[model samples]
Target: MDAFNLAKQRYADLGVDVEKSLQTLAATPVSLQCWQGDDVGGFENAGGALTGGIAATGNYPGKARGPAELRADLDLALSLIPGSHRVNVHASYAELGGQKVDRDAYTIEHFAGWVDWAKQRGLGLDFNPTCFSHPLSADGFTLSHHDEAVRKFWIRHGIACRKIAGEMGRRLGKTVITNFWMPDGFKDTPVNRRAYRERMEQSLDEIFAVAIDQQCNRDALESKLFGVGFESCTIGSHEFYMGYTMKNKKVLCLDAGHFHPTETLADKISSVLQFLPEILLHVSRGVRWDSDHVVALDDQTRALMEEIVRGDYLSRVHIGMDFFDASINRIMAWVIGARNTQKALLLALIEPRDRLRKLEAEGDYSTRLALLEEAKSLPFGAIWDEFCRRNNTPVGVAWIPTVKDYEKKVLSARK
Candidate 1:
């Protein structure tokens, strides 16, 4: 209590409200991706390898084999992390009843259990249409496939997934964001690129043709530069999605790891918000390509959150995780990634924005640079430690032993 008071007074001296920051942080929700639990292997029982430029590297023991186990693992993770949050589900993670069902024919009934689970836990939900690792998308193209049959198949899948998202929001009494990301591209440079993009434009129009109330479900389209097999060209490039979003007044998803090596999502947040009403961010780390490495409290991560806070776009920018690393304990991976995201946001919230903004506006570059560098060494760790105590989460590295115990008592029993 004494240390926390000192830190609070220190922040107060800088004209930053630490209590307000914690309150705002508590209200903000980070959607945790479910794919990390099972390494993108959903409950369809599709005994096939992941295709379309997506791959999970490790063969970690005790991977969630079904919906129930996955939910339990998520519960453990949620317990360790502070603040309210949501779960991001892929269409592939449906609760099929041992009966074979295709992605296109999916319905809200398949996800009833998930809704109940989330509702019980007082958590919000987000969804994505899984368009890869299936027969129709075997050729590395889905929404932009050259074949009419393949294109329509993916279109139906998108439409169905949107409706499911609507139902989730309707029942939970909160708007659910259904994001669309397809691995539609070419392994080699195609003779004609416009043809594929044209098909994609038409397919997206058809999928969004049915009027679903925005209050129930909001639509977001994601773009990518390249994937494992589709290195030559990606149909849904950032330019394409930005244009579509502006015209349609829908959310444009900017994935952290989906862009070129040199580009960062931080610099694009304000620019995108200028044109679009809202934006969704898939927070992941890319080593060289879109590797989906677990996120850390790095400089890039801090910059991303700082941009959001400084721009006052917290409400407009939705934050969600999109990485999957099977090398570590999956539960700990979720905790680490989620905590780091929250930490970054906390650090951003604690910044003396008014002072910096005034300096920038008045052209006091020297003082601004000095203060910015000085802030890096502030007592942020003390506030973060107090935040964990307030939220009843484990402080610092204390949560690690809990995860290891769970691995021994639960995960190890799976095999």
Candidate 2:
């Protein structure tokens, strides 16, 4: 069949109305993690650690020069990707001697400025704390560390930035979202490991306290219109995993690829969801034991994808493509990654659940297991085609399509 007619027939078979599916897809917002001047040669001068012994210099090409240039680039990128507004800013500096030392000031002011700028453009900000600057945080930012002064400094800086973000939201009529990921683990036996976890929580408490204060301040100013949204992620092995702390917070931003090299992705997702039903997912692809390549999903990663679809957390979910690619055009990488992730998520939502049910009824784990395997290996193009085709109707596009569509086609159809 021709591509268009094949698409049409697929829609008919899935009992989906085309127009409604498009609307549904359009409604799903795809957020991105972008550097300030990733395009227009601006990333060249930002000044940071070199990767793989290569000096980090002006690698990106575009019109951006400084902060304003970077901000403009982000604005343009968001414009091209519809329903995408959130940008994760990577704040880093090598030294406090010159312009690099003043990065704290620049970062604070630039982010606050961007928050204002994003308001004008109707976008959101996702601020990630300092991680790239290894010299400053060589010992990591855990509470158990002996660097009391440095730890205090980190807390003060975080509070200051968040306060500025909160104030900007009040003035600009937008929301400021924050995500915290602490590098606080050890490879060897720690002298005082328990002390470290406690300290980390203590630091987090201080940060959370500031957030609560900022939320109140924002709430009081605008009648609770522009409140702060707090999220945190950690490597899966943290002493007190993110889900444990997220109970008091709004949501945990689960990094699907951050679990240990040998850990099962699906088990991690199931565990986190069981603990915290509402989550903000950070999607990236990598082997269980290798570096983050930022490639699309493989078989192992799909296990988590399946749980995300079958669970009840899709609506509250916000998707972000988190990866590093210095050689490729940064904006294009983001755009392509976002598009591919959209396809993956939609496929997970549409996979036939009746097959899963039959496998359960017959105590046949193999078919259900194979279904997840198949779901993961399905090509991105095929997934998007199927999603668009199956979601072609208003009824097919109803509330929480995954759950509802599963009920209509699989559950009701069986009856």
TM-score for each candidate, following the candidate numbering? 0.99, 0.69
In model 2, the Cα lDDT at residue 201 comes to 60
**Candidate 1 runs further than 4 Å off:** none
User: How does model 2 score by TM-score?
Assistant: 0.69
lDDT tens digits, residue span 1-415, model 1: 7888898898889899999999999999999999999999988864468988899998788889788899999999999999989999999888888878899999999999999999999989999999899989888999888789989999999999999999999999888999988888988889999998999999999999988889989999999999998999999999999999899888999999999989978999999999888999988999988999999999889999999999999999899999999888899899999999999999999999999999999999999999999889889989999889989999999999999999999999986
lDDT of each: 0.92, 0.49
lDDT of 2 by residue, 16-131 (tens): 34444445556666667664234212232443443211122335334234555456445544544434456655444112223343333433454555556666776655555543
On TM-score, the leading prediction is 1
Error of 2 at 356 (Å): 4.6
Clashes of 2: 16
User: What stretches of model 2 exceed 4 Å from their correct place?
Assistant: 1-5, 15-21, 36-45, 50-65, 79-83, 91-109, 131-138, 141-143, 168-175, 185-188, 211-236, 243-247, 287-290, 300-302, 354-415
Model 2 global lDDT (CA atoms, 0 to 1): 0.49
* Per-prediction tally of clashes: 0, 16
